[model samples]
Target: MELKIDESIIKAYGFTHQNINIQQIGSGHINGTYLLTKLPSNEKFVLQYINTNVFTNPKAIANNIQAVASFLNQQFPTYLFPAPLLTVNGENMATYNGSYWRLSPFVDDTVALDTLSSPKQAYEAAKQFGKLSRLLNGFDSNKLQATIIGFHDLVLRFEQFENALANANTAFKTKAAEEIEAAINYQYILNNYLEIKDVLPDRVMHHDTKISNVLLDQNSYEGVCVIDLDTLMPGKFISDLGDMMRTYLCEFSENETDFSKINIREDYFAAMIEGYLYEMGSILTKKEKEAILFSGKYIIYMQALRFLSDYLNGSVYYPIHYPTQNLDRAKNQLKLLQELVDNEEKLQDIINQSLLKVI
Candidate 1:
C-alpha cells in the first residue's frame, strides 16, 4: 500500500546516511509502521504515524515513552529498548499534515513474530516482560501519564459494558443474549482487579503484551526488547502478566472462528510461569503471588466484555470486518475464558511449582 508521507517529515529526523529506503512492515492492527533503511550502512529505524483516533493526546504518549526510556537507560543500559528518535527541532514526536509521527532506531538482528512459534519463544517473551516490570519496580509510576485514560480500569469497563447492554437495540440484544448472559455470569472474574488493587503494589506495566510486541534475536530466539510502548502506564503487575497469559498461552489467536482450536496450552502456560517468576517471584508479595493464576481469567474475561460491549453498541469502538465479527470475537474470548477456568487448578499448580523452583 502506498503511504502519502511527505519527504520533509523524513528529512526532519536528520539521518546522516546518503540514501534511505522506507517500507511498511509488520501486521499491526493500530497505527501505520514503516522500516527506514539507510544505504551503505544498512542501518534501519522504525517510523510510525501515531493513531490519533485511538490516542487523543500524542504529546502525552510521547512523554510516557520518554520517561520510561530515560529511566530504563539509566537503570539498565544493557537492556534493548526502542528509544524515540528526536526530530531536528529536538522533539520526540512531530506534527505534519495534522498527523503525529515518531521514530526509533530499530533493534538490529532481531525478529518479532506475530504468534508464538514455540514454547521457548513464549518463555523468552514472558521473561523479557517480567524483567521489564522488575527493572521498573523502583520507578515512580504516578509520574507517568495515562496515554489512554481508563485504559485498564476494570470498574469503568464493567460500567461501559452495562451501559452498552442496557442501551442496545432490541434486535442486537436478542442476538447477543447468550453472550451477554455469559458475560454477566462472569462479572466476578473482572471484579478480581478491584479486590487485589489495594493489596498489590501499582507499578509500570506494558499493558499490551502480545507476542508481536516482543523482539527476539533472529538466531538464538532470545527475547531482546519489549517494544510497543504506547500503553506504558501505571497499573497492576498482574495485568501485564495476565496479558502474557491471555496472548501467549492461547493455542490460537482471539479472532479464530474455530472455538475448538482455542484451548489454553498447558505447556506454554508452564513455560510462561517459569520465565515470569524467574524475574518476579522474589518481589511479588504473598497476596500478589496468590492472585497470579487468576490474572489470566481477569484479562480474558475483561477482553470478552469489551468485545461484547462493542458488538452490542453497533461496533463503534473496534473496526469490524463483518456485521457479527465482534460477536464472533466475543464468543472466542469467552470460550478461551471457559477453558482457562476449567484448567485453573492445573495452572495454579504450574505457578506453585515454578515458584518453588525459583525459591
Candidate 2:
C-alpha cells in the first residue's frame, strides 16, 4: 500500500498535503485510492491513480465522466455525481510519473457495502442504478467508449466455452463431466439472448451494478449515488440489471461450495425487480419487458460458462485453490440458475405485478 504520491502532484491541484492529512481508503484492486482531508476546513477529496494496465485509455474514462456529470447537472441538478476535479490546466485527468491521476470531493455521511444484509438494501441499490439509466435515457451511448469490449456478450462467451470444450484435456474434461454437460445444456440461454438482444435497446448503462458500487446513507441505508464509473460504457440495459440479479438474488456468492446454501431469495428478487422496474418500466418497450425477466438466468449462465471454460483451459482465467474449484463454482452458478428457472413462474408473476404499478 506504499504510494509515493509526489508532493508536486498534490500541489499541481492548488492543494498541499502539508495542510491535508492523507489516508488510504477503499478495497478496490484496480486503482490506488486515498482520502485527502484538510483538517481546519474539514474538506475531504478522494484521490486515485488510474490503473493504466487494465484501462489503457485513461482520458476516455475522464471524458466519459465529465460528459455524464455535465448531463446530470443540466438535467437533474440535485443528483450527486462524483465528477473528477479538473487540474489547473483545465484537464479532467493529470499525467504525473507516467500514471494518470484525478481527484473528486467526497460525499459525506455515505457508506458502501460489499455485501447485502437486507432486501431493502437490494431495492435501494437497484433503484439508484435504474434511476441513473432513466435519467441518461437521452444521452448518446455511442459517444462513450467501451472500456472492455464484449464484456457481457453471451455470444462471444458461448463460443469461448465451445472452443474450450473442444480443446480441453481428456482427463480434466472427464473430471468436470457433470458441469460440462450443464454448460452445453444451457446453450438455450444464449439463444434466448440472441432472440431478444436486437430489440433490447442499448442505453447509457452502469455496466457494473454490484451493491458496493453504490454509496448509501449511513443511517437510513437509502442510496446516495452510484460510484466506480470506470466501467461506464455503451451496453444493453440487461448488463446492469442482470448483474444485480446475478449478485443480489442469492445470499451466497459463486465461491460457495455447499450447493444447499445457494437458493435464491424471493423477497430480495421482488425488491430488486420492483426497484429497477419502478424506474425503468416506462422507458422499456414491450419486447424488452417481456425479455428482461430472465436476466438472472442470462448472467448466471454466462458466468458459469466462464468458470467452466476456464477450468477446461487448465484453470487459466480465474485462480483456483484446488483442482476443481472452478468446476465447483460453475456448478454453484448452475444450481442457482436452476433455482431461478424453477421459480420462473413465480418470479414472472412478481414482474407482472411490479409492471402493473410502475408502468
lDDT of 2 by residue, 1-359 (tens): 45878887787677787788889998776789989998689799998989887788888888888888998899999988888898887878777778888988899999999899999999999999999999999898888887777888999999999999999999988999988888888889998899888888888998889988999999999989999898898888888988998899889988999999999899999999988988898898888788776777888899999999999999986867898899999999999999989989999998899999975
Q: Report lDDT (CA) for all predictions.
A: 0.87, 0.88
* CA lDDT, candidate 2, residue 328: 92
Q: How well does candidate 1 score on lDDT at residue 264?
A: 86
**In angstroms, how far off is 44's CA in candidate 1?**
1.0
For every candidate in turn, the CA RMSD to the true structure comes to 1.6, 1.8
lDDT of 2 at 123: 95
Off by over 4 Å in 2: 320-323
After superposition, the stretches of candidate 1 with alpha carbons farther than 4 Å from their true spots are 15-18
Query: Worst 10-residue stretch by lDDT in candidate 1?
Result: 1-10
**lDDT score of residue 154 within candidate 2:** 96
Query: In TM-score terms, which candidate is top?
Result: 1
For 134-237, candidate 1 gives per-residue lDDT tens digits of 99998999998888998877888899999998899999999998999999999887666777788888889999999899999999999898998999889888
| Native-to-model Cα distance after best TM-score fit, residue 119 in candidate 2, in Å | 1.1
TM for candidate 1 is 0.96
